[model samples]
Target chain A: MSEKHLQTGDELPAFGGKLRLFAMRFCPYAERSILVLNAKKIPYDHVFINLDQKPEWIFTFSPKGTVPALEYEQGKGIFDSNIINYYLDEKYPEVPLQPTDPLRKAQDKMLVEQLTGAQSAYYTAAFSSPSLTPSMVETYHKGLEVLQKELEVRKTKFLHGDEPGLVDYTIWPFLERFQALPLLGKQEFAIDKSKYDVLTKYIEEMKNVPAVKSYCLAPETHAKYIESRAKGNPDYNMLDTSAVCCMRPRKKKE
Target chain B: MSEKHLQTGDELPAFGGKLRLFAMRFCPYAERSILVLNAKKIPYDHVFINLDQKPEWIFTFSPKGTVPALEYEQGKGIFDSNIINYYLDEKYPEVPLQPTDPLRKAQDKMLVEQLTGAQSAYYTAAFSSPSLTPSMVETYHKGLEVLQKELEVRKTKFLHGDEPGLVDYTIWPFLERFQALPLLGKQEFAIDKSKYDVLTKYIEEMKNVPAVKSYCLAPETHAKYIESRAKGNPDYNMLDTSAVCCMRPRKKKE
Candidate 1:
């Protein structure tokens, strides 16, 4: 429940005897696993870590100290957002997030792959605005177009049919963050209603999805984080208000 | 069965009513799929394409005109080597390349993810020698260490188990090509037996894998291809010996 990001030399939190996820607060890749956990309604503890000043112990969970590593067992861990999400889908199985059909699963993975270019463009427009080229802008729109076209073809409430599945969850984080570009003065990156009517509708619908609604941050907040990160001093603890916790509940004796 | 790569203006070959894969002769990514297909004993047709001057029809199969695109059902296609291979493993369930266990599958994927750094270093050392850095070299060795460490822990004949699985098939193409680095004058990239005893033994065993032995090219051959590719004019048709028809048998009347 704590939003605070632990940094270097930070003590490893005592194992609470539950599934634990090591992640950064604002990373989209990390957000992906968070959304999956919420969707699966799985009980898990979250340990937010500062990516810039990563805690030494983070490497124990992820070889490269990357976020979104799942402490599945007491000391064992699994890294990578897709790997974690897929494992969750298979391991839990009660609330399957992927299609039963293998071909459809593969197709879902391909659609996710198609969005890579758009993700690159979004990163450029967000943190390296000056280096944002015309081609990248084109790629940004191409990503939207691909989503829109797929939406038209599937004709489903969500890309995953009646409910958003792995493809939708995997991609929704990027869509969530892309909305912040225009807020950050990158008007060219906007997903206009005129050009992306289907995609825009889908975005609005995704915002209401229970899994996404809880963990999703507002575009303005994302823009602020982007600004800080772009300035070379990321406010990793922006959401940690323990210092000013006037309404904080007193801790019970353990 | 032509080793020839089809270029622009080349006619699309008859589909033969069998599964077909679009690929380049020397592309490692393409080779990954080829190995999987061979391992699974799946009946599929291979179409080698000139990557630099790709045939127009390639896009019909893969939007980016990239190789290892599978024409799964006549004209319908699936791109990305991983996607295609996973689909193959699932579609043709007779020979499952991936483990059924979700955790083990996740671990296999993570290992592949860890190899990305080494792959980048290999690319630089092979094609852009001037840009190769000390850190890149270190990263490459780190990749080897990761594999060796996994082998030590798993204590399996192959990364996949007694029989080589998806993990082995996916990583073997890179190991095969890594041998070419030393032959190309990048001696530092060698997988020294003294340092990588387990990996060296594993490499030899992988070379003997029926799926790999039938399709694997020698280090000298890969070095020749790398040389041609680095010079900016890839010899896409170097393996096409149709022009020298002295030993060719005359076609029978169809």
Candidate 2:
């Protein structure tokens, strides 16, 4: 009977019905949602929202009022990208995005959190300024260093060890953005692929995955989108690696 | 094949066997794991760890080396608190911790992430410092204001609409800590609980939940633990909230 409950009315379709993702192409969190969907191969509709002007429906569904919200008609809408990923994996149960081993799954989730929660903010801060500040650059480098050290020890093809898993999918898009930031002449925190061989190989392997390779928007497209944003023409529609990772439809070509 | 993987060895126990949680008592993230087990009525063994000097065995299992890790008999170890909670709900389907609806689940997860990832940090920074700098105070206030506004709009008995859900369990422990911090004379930020009647009432309601009430350590005991840490005792035995929340059999009954 409260306004929150009323607002959170059954907005998503019924369970097993079509899944719709309300996402921003550039949002790493949105990309995390996209990656899980892709891993599961769940076919869903994608609505790309403009960051400058989020769709009204998003505010209606998301109490936190952030993008990467999912609608699965089980009589309600799902708001978090990570939770949406879990729901899809649980409901679909075809190609599990998470490892079967409980502990490994937890490790994957933790790694993803580190990237999304901690490192992502540092990257955002470093990139948000018109010109990167020295401290921001230092923070960004520190984040990368932590990740680099972690990756060194694990040495898996992806973040979750071995084949591309949830953690890799969750983090790759954000790193992809960081990799491209140098295009904007902000290269101070650019990850030197040569220096971190394991990470370089991991990125390359991710690029080669069928779902990732086919569905991911080209780097050129993302560059163009960034350029468009900088030019004051804000409706940039190119999907980031995260969005591409999640939105890959499971059903094959007819 | 590596030493890390081989330590647990191949003969991992089945999923239904003993569940061991390595966690810190006061950590909100660890509280999430406890919440799931409490909700599901699952029995487990709790291992409290000193987070400051993490044991070698824990580091071997938890690659990221964070608390709220789980060691399941099935030769699995999970690191993130959220992932462990999800795994428990999935593995034990009898008492469902997640909502049936996907969207509601998403909302629950998002709120949890907001609490764990963002708001909790704000509260920690707010409560730990003697006097917050102007900028630090602003950030803390901003976070609280957002949470307060959201709570005002929601007006639910718990974080989820009708009943206590994942978010409530995951977040309440931190909120409890925040409330208790003022008593410690560590109040750097002000919280006007009066403005958000629902949140205030919800906290009161949470205190009465048998599962929550019975498992939570008494405020005085918890304060003692915090005091020891403040006094520069490095070898402190921190209670893992997971153990408390899960209502695991303790050596000494309260």
Location of the lowest summed lDDT over 10 successive residues in candidate 2 chain A: A1-10
Model 1 regions lying over 4 Å from their true place: A250-254, B250-254
Q: Per-prediction TM-score, please?
A: 0.98, 0.62
- How well does chain B match by TM-score in each candidate? 0.97, 0.74
Per-residue lDDT of B1-254 in model 2, one digit per residue for the tens? Answer: 01111112233222456787766666667777877787778887666565665656676456566878788764457777767877787788886656777545655566555544345444445344544455665555555555666667777666665666666777777666665555566455445677555556777888887668866766555556556655656324343343455555546533
lDDT of 2: 0.62
Best by lDDT: 1
Q: Which candidate has the highest DockQ of all?
A: 1
Instruction: Give model 2's docking category.
Output: acceptable
- How many backbone clashes does every candidate have? 0, 18
